[model samples]
Target: MKYKYILFDADDTLLDFGKAEWFALNKTLEDIKFNCNKYIAEKFSSICDKLWHEFKLDEPLNRYVQINYHDLYYKYSVERFKDLKELLDINISAQLLSEKYLNSFSECGFLVKGAENVCKQLSLQYKIFVVTNGLSHVQKSRIGNSKIKSYITDILISEDAGCAKPGKEFFDYSIKSLGTSNLSEMLIVGDSIITDIFGGNEYGIDTCLFNSKRKINKLKIQPKFEIRELNELLGILRI
Candidate 1:
């Protein structure tokens, strides 16, 4: 199927979020007068990943509480730091640490190996939009400093959408912003099956799974297309 609009996920899709997260986590820990080791940082990653998955679930299996709409990103992100603080038995304020992490992460513009090439090449033929479950300022700052910033047509963040991936409200905002009623003419590509593939499939649009790490898609969901590399996308789209 031909696609005029290609919505890409920022973290783990184009941006090297893992490295950026490591850098940010270390910086945040340092701010608290603590040094971060691989184990400590990985623990933080695990905690945040679980919280992110919960954020995407329909009922948030583990969290049955009412959703907090105000400062959605801050609410969701600070919770991860709260969990991390408890695990580390730290006295530092979770809110302050989370803010520091965001500030540090915003300075990161590290791209995946072929990200610039893919975005640069695809921008010529397709309307490229970054669809992310992230803080607006952090994402914008990271992208703005990157070379592909010029290639990106725009960005849609959950903070702005007031909803996140795997949720219909977010997809509704995305579709309307894309200004295209034809689902067949659009595609959503990302490394996540839950957010990108499952969400796109549920929304009646084509989905492409970018499995760069070769992780197993344990979920029942499947994407319409899959590629192991960003450059491989050029071949799939016949660019």
Candidate 2:
């Protein structure tokens, strides 16, 4: 009720990340003459999630990406034809996969239910910002192409800020960029407890965990609030 700034998470919280990732990866695998089966896709998701969790635990970005891909390749025995470098050949494979993912991701632009409307309504009273752990170009592309872009006051991506979420530095950068000195006058809304909620809590900002899936197990780190729908924010904000 006292917040003047509202920060949001980009991936699953705002955008339908799972849908986009599935479409892109499936298409990319098919294009590369690989079987894009559900099992493979699920495996890839698990691998990516683990890598991200490691990143949250303070692994360097470069090492995180490299190790993740390397492990995936190893697990799939993808080096039968060539080495990891040859298999990943950025220009041919990595870049293509990234582009495909971004394209599919940008094309969908599906916001959680009431997200756009909430942004529009909240924009009248609060300055809205997006704090995400992602490449700047990719995050910017998604934001610029999304319906909520017009309502957002600013966006802070990890690549541009040289830090990722759950890190105090990234939250500091976001606070500075928002030109707000009172941490209590800010709220962070996101789906990830380890990233969004924990990061915001570290910065002394109120956090609302968007647990839409209702999958969060018993955890020690409790968010200030939890909601299953974006519209539920109205109740918390008293809008």
Candidate 3:
């Protein structure tokens, strides 16, 4: 096989993080005696998604959650909660809300459609690792509780590596930790163009974009392979 190892992004790529976040955020808001609705969940996800993308690029973001640090550690997530509190006019502290949201989130784990079957099939011939940018405990609990957990060789999270994706430091740390120098033998598959595709491209490895959303108009860089579904990988790998 040309590729001996596969680095897959967890959220959206394999796990249904949208569903997890919706349930967790609603539960957290309800816990604080706030009316939880779809609008609130949508707004919250927008804020968080922007903050994280900005943080990854080391850009100053929303005033409430802006930080000089680039790591997507728990502290950064707490800052995000601050943004959430300010926007939603919540009475609770950011730290308190962060705790509530994370606790609720960790308990909610659901795979993207075909994720389990895809991972199981790929594991038969290649080393598959979940390369993700997320809070350590949250990623651990979510992934550990999922059915795909058995197929994954390991979950490589940004918090544990001290750097997130789209940066050379993160790729450097991940590659070294994986004990591999031949970049050609590995492939990166993910939903995020910036994080997974860009990072893998910069690292000189083949990248496959799981464009489940099919929004391809804004791609700054092109990946080596593209698939609309996990099952398509069977043809790519000649499995």
Q: In lDDT terms, which candidate is top? A: 1
3-31, model 1: which lDDT tens digit per residue?
99999999999999888888888988887
| C-alpha RMSD (angstroms) for model 1 | 3.2
Clashing pairs for predicted structure model 1, backbone only: none
RMSD of each: 3.2, 5.5, 3.7
Misplaced by over 4 Å in model 2 are: 29-40, 46-108
The C-alpha lDDT values of all candidates are: 0.84, 0.72, 0.82
Q: Model 2: per-residue lDDT, tens digit, 1-239? A: 78899899998888778776777667766666665777767766765666445433334334343334334332332222122225334345444455555555555566777888999899999999988876566677788878999999998987666666676667777878988688888899999887787677777889999999997547577899999999999888998
Error of 1 at 32 (Å): 4.8
For 60-120, candidate 3 gives per-residue lDDT tens digits of: 2222222223344466678888988998888889999988998999987799998888888
Q: Arrange candidates by TM-score, highest first: which order?
A: 3, 1, 2
Please give the lDDT score at residue 193 for candidate 1. 83
Against the true structure, what is each candidate's TM-score? 0.84, 0.76, 0.85
